[model samples]
Target: MFDRHKSTPAFTRFTYFTFTYFTHFVRSAMTAFTLIILTFIIASIFHGLTGIGVTLIATTALASSYPMSHVLVLTVIPCLLINLVVFLDGGRIVYYLKKYWLLVLTSFVGSFIGTKLVFIIASHHLLIALGLLIVGYVAMQFVAMSVGKNFKLPNTTPSLVISGTIAGVLGGATNAMSPLLVMYLLSATEYTDDPKTELIKASNLCYVVGKIAQLIVL
Candidate 1:
């Protein structure tokens, strides 16, 4: 008599393969999700301390694997909320707005324009641009530290306009403007009693504005 259970059916092998594939897929997906969350947490902590790292950290860290467009989308909300919290944490909203109204206006315009370009550009190009932006910022920081930056810009209309527009465009395009704004505020407030506060306030203000621009365009 032929043994009825002697041989495995093809369906058994197919079912085994499917189950293995599904299990592996689920595990891999969970791992990726966890790592992404971990990256965001680290970035958030750094931003809380420095008032600038969320975008810089997230953008550079995730850009290699994820499309820059998706990374920016992930970044836009958290960055906005963090900046709002930080900016409000210090208070004096009236003072900051009054002082930086022009800066805010110019940044809004530049950010809006820059954000519009994001949709038109290719994802790979945007990724490359973001990578270069981070690298350039790091290089500039190195130069500033090693060579000792001494020149100071007066916080005049011209300086504020230029800085605000550039920072806004940079923030809008790459979602990392802290490097430029940090350098700018440090240079401009050589005589302020509380330079650190000024930096937090100014940078957060610009960041908030740039985020608003991004949100509007998006």
Candidate 2:
């Protein structure tokens, strides 16, 4: 006459914890899916008008509910796909690769190292760092736009290498590198006349390389 209905205390605790974890996972997944859909549409519109904002929009949307590292990882595929589409549409992939090979190579190296760092860092610290990076990028953009065409950043070898490295690290950490990339390109005197097409092409190429490196590291 064993008690068939009674469960052991350890078994009860295990069941409770398992169910709680499953419930939280399901809720987070659902919320992430919904936010991604909404943000994709909005980001697409902005990306169409300007050659940026897709990753920023997606990362910002997911950052509140999920860890920043998770958001960066999840956005990598989508960002890569979108950049591929844009790169193909422009029909200048070969030209960009040939022209900016050095910059691209350095960026890839930086991104590989940065991606490794993401895993080593704590989740809370990553979130705070990402927040500050986003804020700094926005402020930099505002000031640059306010200053208009007067500002200039020479595209020397050192400048390109430094900017590319910074862009790669930021891209790896938060998946938001367009602000820095765009600013760097815009500041160049050659690109100052009419930068839209060149800017889009260059940024897409850089993003494609960075995303590929991130996927490899991940």
Best candidate per lDDT, number? 1
For candidate 2, the C-alpha RMSD (Å) to the true structure equals: 3.6
78-135: candidate 1 lDDT, tens digit per residue: 8789889888995899988887788788888878877877788887887777778788
Candidate 1 displacement at residue 146 in angstroms: 2.0
> Which 10-residue span in candidate 1 carries the lowest summed lDDT?
149-158
- Identify the candidate with maximal TM-score: 1
Measured against the true structure, the TM-scores of the candidates, in listed sequence, are 0.84, 0.82
User: What value of lDDT does candidate 2 attain over all alpha carbons?
Assistant: 0.77
Off by over 4 Å in 2: 1-28, 150-152, 189-194
Clashes of each: 0, 0
> Which residue pairs come into collision in candidate 2?
none
- Tens-digit lDDT track for model 2 on 30-115? 98688888888788788778777788888887888787767777788888888778877848678778887877887777777778
> How many clashing residue pairs, candidate 1?
0
TM-score computed on alpha carbons, candidate 2: 0.82
